[model samples]
Target: MIPPATPSPSAPKPSRQRQIGGLEFILLMGLLQALQALAVDSMLPALGTMAVDLGARDPNQRQLVVGIFLICSGLGCLLPGTLADRYGRRPVLITCLTSYILCSTACALVTNFDQLLVLRAILGVACAGLMVLPAAIIRDRHEGDAMARLQSTVGIVFMVVPMIAPSVGQAVLLVASWRWIFGVMALLGSLILFWMATRLPETLRPEFKQPIAPRKLAMTMGAIITTRSAAGYVLGMALIQGAMFGYINSSQQLVAEHFGAGARFPLIFAGMAACMACSNFTNSRIVEKFGARRVSHTALLIYIGTSALQFYIASQPNETLWEFVPMMTVNMCLLGFLGSNFTSIALQPFARSAGAAASAQSFIRMVLASCLGSMVGQAFDGTARPLAFALMVAGLGCLVLVLFSEKGRLFRRLLPPGTPRPIA
Candidate 1:
């Protein structure tokens, strides 16, 4: 009998010396992602004050504060993954965080809206690493259901940031100028940077590293776009994410002025975010047992049903906060399931090129989502109708794309029973 082939000595071990405790790994990944959430959600409470401070004349322009950041981040996301694939995840991430800290400080001191926006654009570029790297890191460590579970677990912590971020911003505005919110953001970025530099191990395999060549990069990206499973899920994610971003952009207006939540806007927003956190917690528990497709596909259907009802409610002439908030909250909860699972599924096909795949998908997804969000946000006319309509359309689009990817099938596991899961 032939002897068993020996494993190559020079092969890179993904878990070699990188095996921090599972809980620590999850927390680090989650906090890295939460930085972006904090950047967006915390600023929600202060958009009005910041606009007045910066001499903004048009109310619609204030959405640009959030909108510009998201768009720039999307554009910036296109490169980090390619560079990370060549250089390494650790160095690239550290640079991004350093930039984030510096940009946050500059934003705190801006004298005018244009200066603030320019700084925010740069800051968004830095923040792109926060969005892309965490997913790539998880991809480096796990795939399929394990990846979905890990993403959901991290999402539990990520969702917590949005839950309390508005409250944090509101509290800051109570004692200081809205600019102090940027100061707080800078401080948090500093702490996260320190934690990352000291504790997180690099996960990129040695063999996966490649030169940053244009032809190679273009080919990798082309492959990603051509892969039906990946392309479909990426498009679906962008559509759903567009709806979520729309809600984020218009949420303050809908909850505070239109629904008359006013000073209680932070509390109402936190309550809705709390439901999403709960959804992530629940997804973490059940994703592995039922599979990512089954959980997310079912959630997507429920989301569509919920969104249609929300549109109906919003169209009523005398709609109340009670009627609106619950449906919106449910839709947000469903999002917790969709975001991580769709990401995992789209990424399943790319093992060596995970970083590039993540980069391309994030760039496309965020740019498209931000544009759709800007449109939906601008359509706000002192009511929730536009946001609701956008969400319903998003859900339908997502379902269609998913159907195309699955070849008219849904909720079927690709893996058979008794297959052993690889340890991360």
Candidate 2:
């Protein structure tokens, strides 16, 4: 055709670079993070089946399937950033995805509860790479509220996976055994691994690459701990995540047993998750306008207020699903505002050491959060009391940490020098 005849010398190259640089880049990063959410959420429906089949004696012990995975994921978060910094993002990511595929496959074949837990722990370790690397990648390209906006956008997309993950698990359970869920995880991981190998470039710049020295690692970690904004926000994020996990751990039981939702639990859970997705989408739009600190601080106050109301309502006799669901949905929505913003704020101080900083932040946050979540989950008393109370305490704890990080400031439009403030 005429178009194919002769290309002008002034014509731009087919934008091959732009393909993975803009929307595709955000979508890819979102999918990478969604792998972690999928791993956890998709297994929720199968916990009871797994416990019974695997000979777990206590009902509380079923939570270990989730708790142990989180604990191990936290433990493994320390290494990926160092590896990513040394070798490069692409290689480290591919290796981790391969390990994830293998571990998930192994998890499908475990013969006992202990064996399954061991494999899941290893799988969680693989997932840590997926969790930490995306943040580093985002930091590689953008910073400040722009980074927060991108993170929230990713969260908006990533939240969709969790919203449907339980339903996907339930669908699997309807026709196949729980083991098939892990098989599905393996399949998805394989596909993503292939996509990544083909499309994902080395986002780590040559100048940013560093040798994996023990002294250097220690110094970087010390810097992270010593930085007020990083440390405070990281701790605040940890508490908020811990509180979220508490709800996750107890969700199936609370919905099925307490609310009598039974087979409808997946739909109920999906609705709550959808609230989060909406909130993330909304936060992505507004964070640039209000700044991360102002938006998140305001959301945190609402979260604290919601937690108090939820606790009060949960304590009252004859609490209905209508009331509980709305309250929980609001809480989740508030969390949507907090999670990505908190992460962006925490990681803002370290550009050169983004990988290491992300790893340390993930490690500390996951460990503490998982512990708090496990405690709340173990305290499940066949009522909503434990979850509601834990959330309230977590909200208060997060507030304190945020205050510490902000040095008594709240709702301030803080940004780096030379950054343009958003129009009010």
Candidate 3:
């Protein structure tokens, strides 16, 4: 295993690590972040209504409501982890949740496109706190198989929410306006706030808590980029994330144009989401047996393979919805299997600098993913052609990055012959 980066002379770790049910905590945390995701995807189907109702003249403007929010969320991923580290996870989470709730309510109340965009950005920033805090808290408590279990458990909640959130958003549109989506979001955020107030406790210990000083933050950021394994995993994640961005951007067009799924599109999208949820649960069960390194490596290979076949199909003239859906499901399942393991491995070597490390890693990955993914997603030529191109190229490209960053060592770290695995 890769060793943690060197800590400072006066560096400290939790003297008496707090004991808690990691699965429960991480799962709730995942739900909080998933709510942020729901904000983006849930409103996708309602983009036109939002645009027309608000009288946004620009065709590109409706997408900006969701697109800009996503970009902000990516930008927002930078700080919460470090903030949670300096302060306590619970307090930081509470503050973030409160801000998120307020901003989401503002989104619902907005009468203009500009106000909505601005509020969405604020909501994005607050939601950033939701995204980073949970991972940092979970990592503080577990490592290896235990960490994977916690991640998988959390991922199950995360994956499942995306499947249902859009449907709920669609249902809300049936009776109320798109603004009600924000109202529902505010309610959900409040529920999370309540949950944190009661069920959650500070995971960062006194010794582990440092003042949020400039030098410490700089040092923490430096170590992550300097560390070999940490850097590799983060880059690998960014590459995969870019593909995800492309998929999110293109799904609507592809489903409507090629599949002719029309208004029932979210149902099919939800089905693909279901594939991801199942894959995450399976990953949780087997990651202990294979180790994060092995599972990520193998999954990447399969993703690349699936993308290649997709590329071949996209080149053909007679491609149908059947071609896209099945292939995309396989692609998404790989996403579920890899997401938690890559994060666990990347953050593993930075335990001492968990807060700063988590902040920098999450921020960079989000920036990389949003920028690259957005570009690729927008490249769609009103067809599945661009989507397939991005998927295949990004999948293979990410695998190569993993190989390069890790110096070609992957899957070798799986359990030794006949070795047993542990479960949390």
lDDT on C-alpha atoms for all candidate structures: 0.85, 0.84, 0.76
Rank by TM-score, descending?
A: 2, 1, 3
- Pairs that collide in candidate 1 are none
Task: Report the number of clashing residue pairs per model.
Answer: 0, 0, 0
Question: Lowest summed lDDT over 10 consecutive residues: which window, candidate 1?
Answer: 1-10
Compare candidates 2 and 3 on TM-score and give the better one. Answer: 2
Clash count for candidate 3 is 0
Rate residue 93 of model 2 by lDDT.
97
CA deviation > 4 Å runs, candidate 3: 1-30, 57-60, 137-151, 198-208, 348-355, 414-424
RMSD, every candidate, angstroms: 6.1, 5.4, 6.4
How does model 1 score by TM-score? 0.86
Count of clashes in candidate 2 = 0
lDDT of 2 by residue, 1-424 (tens): 1011122232233336433556777788899989988999998889989989999998888888888888888988878877887888888899999999998899899888999988888888889899888877777666665666677667667878988999999999999999999999999999999887787767777776888887876787788789998888898888888988888887877876688887788898998888788887888789888899889999999999999999999999988888899999999999989987898899888978775676677778889999888888999998888999999998899899888888988887766789998899
Best candidate per lDDT, number? 1
The digit string of per-residue lDDT tens for model 3 on 129-216 reads 8777777766666666566556556766777777887788789988998889888988988887887777765666778776667687
* Candidate 2 structure, TM-score to reference: 0.87
